[model samples]
Target: MHVSEHIIDIRYAETDQMGVVYHANYVIWLELGRTKLIEDLGLSYIQMEQDGIVSPVLDLQVTYRKAMRYGEKAIVKTWIEAVNPLRVVYGYEILNEKGELCITASTTNILVKKDTFRPVSFKKLYPDWYEIYVREQKNENIN
Candidate 1:
């Protein structure tokens, strides 16, 4: 499986009244991690948009496993959990400075026409991406 790591320095503004990281901020971190994974695969969302294709989140699921405080670093590990022609599932694990998992999440996204918001197939529009994701997904399943 292909995993991409992005480090985020916990900022004070990202914290809540309890002095731990805010829950909603984790969603943004997931997006950053997903983007990094796509870039690591040599695919650019910007380029896709220029081609009139836009990938939007169909659904998101996140679990808060632990609390994170400021002055700590967040290590976001992202990988392709599953993939299909029409949709992809990206998994994420956010760890604190000690490598303890703080969050576990997944987001399902689909490629759509930016103008009409109609579904499109990565297999048809970007076969290379589909093939790469297939390999990644297979690797994940093997382990």
Candidate 2:
């Protein structure tokens, strides 16, 4: 399975009054990781969107483990956890500079026809993309 790691340095602006990274920042970092992973595989999400197809997140889950402070580095590791006909699940791990786990998360996305906003099977309309997914990603283990 393909996996990518992107580094995110925690900036002052990313921290709140409590001196911890804001919750929403994790989501943003997740997106960065995801985008980088796609590009690493020689694909572009923007191109897919321009092709009249869009993959939107259907679900997201984040679990905070340790607090991350400003001026520290974060390692955002992303993996293609699962690839189905209509859905893709991505797994993530956020680690602090101390090499401690800060958060563990995942997001599930589904492709849809941009005009209809209705789900489309990736294997049917985008076989090339599907083939890459099938060959690179392993199915997620629920347990």
Candidate 3:
């Protein structure tokens, strides 16, 4: 289902005083995962911005499962959970080096005209990308 995996080497700077990765850092990792997924689909957020289109996060949900320490590696698995004309929902799962799930998250993004900040239909803006997501959603349900 169009899943993309991105690996991140945890750095000391990402940890808290107790050496556990800070909760907020997971949110940043989610962004990285989303970016990787888009790039894997042959699209770039930078290029989208250059084209005057922007996707802004409308909602975010993160569930922490375990604590990860600095120096550990994290693999973030991301995919399209759902997509429609007005919004896209991206899902994520962060796993530690031990293969333990550290966090599960999702983000909802709405496409908009960069200058006008008016909502836009992603299907109309990028048919190919929209089609890919639609296919993935179908595949997910089949499995």
Task: Compose the digit string of candidate 1's lDDT tens values, residues 6-93.
Answer: 9999999999999999999999999999999989988888999999999999999999999999999999999999887788889899
Tell me the lDDT of model 1 at 8: 98
* Cα lDDT of model 3 by residue, 14-91, tens digit: 999998999999999999999999999887789889999999999999999999998899999999888887888898
Per-model TM values vs. the true structure: 0.94, 0.93, 0.93
The TM-score of candidate 2 is 0.93
Q: Where does model 2 exceed 4 Å of error?
A: 140-143
Predictions: Cα RMSD each: 2.2, 1.6, 2.5
Model 1: lDDT of residue 68 = 97
Go through the candidates in order and give the clash count of each.
Answer: 0, 0, 0
Candidate 3 colliding pairs: none
Q: All models: lDDT?
A: 0.91, 0.90, 0.89
User: In terms of lDDT, which candidate is strongest?
Assistant: 1
What are the per-residue Cα lDDT tens digits for candidate 2 across 1-143? 88899998899999999999999999999999999899988888998999999989999999999999999999999988888888888899999977899999999999998999999898898889778978888674322
